[model samples]
Target: MRQNDAVAANAGPRVIVFIVFDGVTLLDVAGAGEVFAEANRFGADYRIKIASVDGRDVTTSIGIPLGVTDIAASIESADTVLVAGSDNLPTRAIDPALVEAVKAVAGRTRRLGSICTGSFILAQAGLLSGRRATTHWRNVRAFARAFPDITVEPDSIFVRDGDVFTSAGISSGIDLALALVEQDHGTDLVRDVARWLVVYLRRAGGQSQFSSLIEADPPPQSALRAVTEAIAANPGADHSVRSLAARASLSTRQLTRLFRSELGTTPAGYVEMVRIDIARSALDAGRTVTDTAHLAGFGSTETLRRAFVEHLGVSPKAYRDRFRTAIGT
Candidate 1:
């Protein structure tokens, strides 16, 4: 057994405490907690707890009430601490008491992490001042402006800097937790836990948080909007600039201008993005590489491979191996 595995084998269950607060996003807490619980169910020794500032009942953003322990008391012996995100973080100021409590607990914990905007709290506590971290994509710019010292990766699902980890919004918290489980036990256990949870065993941190399908938001009546919708609906159709211009009833030059002005990409670029998105979905569904290439409008496996690498930083076969759910391998 590895050193960490041997330690886990001899020691009692490691305590994984989640720090929650008013207006917390329930999924951030629930998702990570479920991952650890599933790991425990798979014979890993982990004890999970929900903790808050006062150990009182707190209302989640969606109005669910959760009972939590007082972090000041409960966190002293924690092996790992995760701060759950809050919807109110961007508007409201960080609580001084909570910051102090997090700082105190983090000082003694073996591992520390945050989920989504919980990174805001970690930043306030000075834990992330010199580390790389990430949060929700919507808040990435503001988070960077607020914490200039920390390197914020807006696209990553999760980032680990030394002993500290931070995940992107919502569901990515589950990914981070599974990664921690893999670190403590092994890949085999993590795979079992992931299969139980029905999630990818690993979505590499580099995978984008935003899919190309939803990246551009054009006006409802804009030609760019119509063209984008058409591309989405029929990814395999000819989406050359001339073809798209004809569909939108504009000259090719006019269509190119509109694409840049409204969607911030050329028509061809947008078409490639849409094709990549379609290819990802097709691959996830266990489609053959050749079939996915044709269906996604790449027309050949080589073309699809290049686009997959350019957009997703992985090859078609590698992407399929990591994310395919249909085969149940």
Candidate 2:
């Protein structure tokens, strides 16, 4: 079937099935479900369901119980099938039955998606082979190693390759669901849903999952951590290699080597990433583009715009227009 063809075929509500498993991440299942539920509230016709290998109750990673239907019953005529992520991935063995079921379901569904480590499930089912996909940034190396045939885009928030979609981490599932909603309905409705949920209507799929402040791996108890913390705290400061090296009590060559060894980036690259993260947050908070540029230490709006486009694949104004909540609208 063509992507979204099932939704368009029947004049009735589209059936969205969440394929969950034992030790699933609760947010991966709930976050995407909430977006579709909110879309329904905005007048979109969609019906959601939670399904597992067998029709039974499954415990989430955090010990929450979720009731689910059997995959056999749920996949009968699904418009969209989303495979929810698991906390026990890469290390845990997936049921062969579940993999076979997913392979069968993919042929019948209009579109299929996986959230975070759920991409591993899809890949195991052979659904993601030869497709461009992504998962949690932390798992990218392992995923690539396991599935050499799949093209993994580690930095992307989400990726859409033909009828298959994949999202990074937990919250990114919400972004993918919102994108699906926009595809099935329209931007206005998805925008309203995003407003209600207080999230970006659409964080560009190309946006990096790693924020230098949060995701960068710095050596513990090392000067590199201090330098990174300083950069994050004062993004507006002069973060040239010389300035940062002095603050870290290291020579410029020492700082550069430490950054590359500990953080996998050059000192200048690390500074730019931190600045971009700050600028993105400021834009999401509804700050003016020009003001955000200066505040994030880009020196000028034009410079900031280039950084946004280079890093996020979208202009700053476009990102803000899509994500900034209208305070009283």
Candidate 3:
């Protein structure tokens, strides 16, 4: 807060501008801003400025009032410009005034990036076209559908595509800010910041570790729905394509066809996906690796290892370690 108050008064610090709006996510601004602020204590001077479209203070998502440093159109000497995200960004349309303000500031900033759903603002401004980016996992499908030109990395904590970088929301947003600070300083300086903040210098894995894949409703078709329910009820059961087809009262080929048509996967693939979901649950609940493999219906630990790697990109033991790791060293 002190750094933000004295930013314009300081002459030599690199200007960091954040374009905020009404209903802006507070952590999206604070998490990243704190990284730069902590870096300053180590002699990395980053002058933080919070700007709005019309130069008026706005309310945050949590209903806290945030002060404004300047209007977006007046942003200058910005070493980096970050747009904070909002909860309504995914469901509502981007404000045209905000888009124009971002575009105007981009011309002067050396680096342009966003935290959380702020990528939507960058996308709406036509700046992330043909760029690889990411956002909160819940919005990945909608974002990809809305912008066919942008390559959306659905599970990355953060992604750097040339000069425009985008990152996931909340804690992942903090990770992105740490990476930016690393680029300007070095690993040593970033490690100090991470230590001061009591977080990992670099956290493991991606957003997939935190997202739920089994929350969707079961298939609507009775036969397909029955098979899905059976799979979820007892992943340890013998759910071979033949067994499932028999339960669904369809020929093996027809069952395979239905699974492909309605579920986008073969019966065997569907079973594995469900089993993986079960395995993830078991791991998260502190089950032993061997126990998790059997409970999740993997015939052997090796088989379970293969499935986990193929789908989640992390071994079961490694995934489990995520839960065990503490915040501080």
Candidate 4:
């Protein structure tokens, strides 16, 4: 089957199925569910459902039970199928039957996704071979060790290569869901969904993990943490590599090296992302683009608008209209 254009706006009603396993991470399944459910809030057509390998009641890692009635056959009819991760215990393994089921469904579904340790399941089914994908960071080494052909970027919060998308741990699943929402419904709708969820506005899949920029190894007395706090506190400020290096008592070259090694981004790019994040927060809180631009440290509304379009592929007003609550309760 052919995959539709990746950036197409919301289409009509589609079925999303999450395959749950024993000792599954409940949040992985719920995170995807919430996004599609919230899409309905914008009058976008979609539905969320749960399925299991055997159409039985499945238990979560935390002991909660989910009564999933659909079976693998449901995957053939699904527009999208999500595979959720099991608890991060070493004992977990993808069932042979589930592997076959996923492979079978993979033949029919429009798209496939994995969350956290669920990437392990996709790898097991041979679906991730030669594809760029990611799992939870804690599992990255093991995943890479097991699947040598898959280009596992250990530092990413998620990876979208071809029709298969994989997200990192718990909260990152929410990020992945918001991205899917944006792809289907538009940026504005996803933003509103994020606001309704009381979370930080969505970060693009390309955005690095929040902790990625911190120094992995620092001298005990180094002021790196304080410097990072200051950067976050004043994201709108002109935070140059030299300035941060001075604040941390390290050479500019040393600071840049640290940022590259830990964050997969230069210090400047990280700061720009911080500013964008602040602007998104302001927009989510109902600020207009003009106000958000000023509050988030952009020198002008036009600059902010251009940046939003370039980085997010949407306008500031559209982002706010899609995400912020229209009726103030």
CA lDDT of every candidate: 0.84, 0.84, 0.85, 0.75
Model 1 local distance difference test score: 0.84
lDDT of 2 by residue, 1-329 (tens): 34555455556889898988779999999999999999989999889988887778889989989988665444777888999888678778888877877777777788899999999999999888899999987788779989999999988888999889999988899999999999888889999999999997856536452443345568688988788888888888888899999989999999999988777689988888888888888988889999999989999999998887887777889878867777853
Over the stretch 14-122, how does candidate 1's per-residue lDDT look in tens digits?
Answer: 8888998889999998899999998988888888888888888789989989888565545656678899998788668999988988888786677899999999999
Q: Specify the highest-TM-score model's number.
A: 3
**Error of model 2, residue 68, in angstroms:** 0.7
**Best-matching candidate per lDDT:** 3
Write down the worst ten-residue block by lDDT for model 3.
Answer: 1-10
Residue 231 in model 2: lDDT: 85
Task: Compute the lDDT for candidate 3.
Answer: 0.85
In candidate 1, position 179 carries an lDDT of: 92
Off by over 4 Å in 4: 1-11, 88-91, 204-329
**How many clashes in each candidate?**
0, 0, 0, 4
**Candidate 4 local lDDT, 28-109, one digit each (tens):** 8887788788878886777777888888889998898987968875655667788899765324656888888888777666
